[model samples]
Target: MKITFLTVGKTEDAYLKEGIEKYVKRLKHYTKLELVELNELKNTKALTPEQQKAKEAEMILKKITPLDHVVLMDEKGTEYSSTRFAAYINKREISSSATLIFIIGGPYGFDSSVYQRANDKISLSRMTFSHQMVRLFFVEQLYRAYTIMKGEPYHHE
Candidate 1:
């Protein structure tokens, strides 16, 4: 199955960009991974947080299809160990032919519509990180999952 990493904004930090790229390149050997970064909403000074999320939701929904399995990277979602995450991916790949889309919403988080559309939700940690930093962390975890699946040394207990 193809995996799509979809985020609401760009990774502006130079260091974060490099880190995300490194894992993305490494991921090429294991699965078909696509990174899609939607442009951040413009002129947000007048918009409330809820309004921003609604507008962002419009853009996000347009990119997804009925056939794609959508998973939101959300704070209140299920938390898993590295091995368990690997197993989750493996299960999806075995059971579904749909494209798996993992979304990272904008600053204020996801809208109700976006949340309603999601098939599952996952949390990286209880502690919060900047949106840009989450990009790096998620990609690195993805790489680690693949390595663990292959019985490689990149991940250790």
Candidate 2:
């Protein structure tokens, strides 16, 4: 099974890129992984929150194939421990009919349409985090999950 991370903006920090790359490489040991970036919508000076989401949502929807199992990286979604997260990924890989996708939306969060299309939602943490930082955290957690699943020493009980 393949896993894809679809995000709405560019990652400006090289530090974030470095951190994400480290874990992303590790994630490949478990499954094929890809990070798809959509161009951020421009000229948001006059747009309302909903309007911004609408424009961003259109671009997001276009990138998503019908067969993809969309999961949002949401703050208010279900939270899991490292072991449970490993199980979740394993479950999807075993049972999913298509690629599993996790999306991180823009500053205003995901649009209503994006929410409608998602099959599940996962929260990396209860505390709110910057979207750029979330990329690093998400990839690290994925690596940690694999370590847990493999009974490796990287993860501690």
Per-residue alpha-carbon lDDT of candidate 1 for residues 1-157, written as tens digits (9 for 90 to 100): 9999999999999999999999999999999999999999999999999999999999999999999999999999999999999999999999885899999999999999999999999999999999999999999999999999999999989
**Which pairs of residues have clashing backbones in candidate 2?**
none
Best by lDDT: 1
| Clash count for each candidate, listed in order shown | 0, 0
The number of the candidate with the highest TM-score is 1
Task: Show where candidate 1 strays beyond 4 Å.
Answer: none
**Residue 112, candidate 2: C-alpha displacement in angstroms:** 1.0
Which lDDT tens digits does candidate 2 get at residues 82-137?
99999998888779648888999999999999999999999999999999999999
Determine the C-alpha RMSD for candidate 2 after optimal superposition of all C-alphas: 1.0
Candidate 2: stretches off by over 4 Å: none
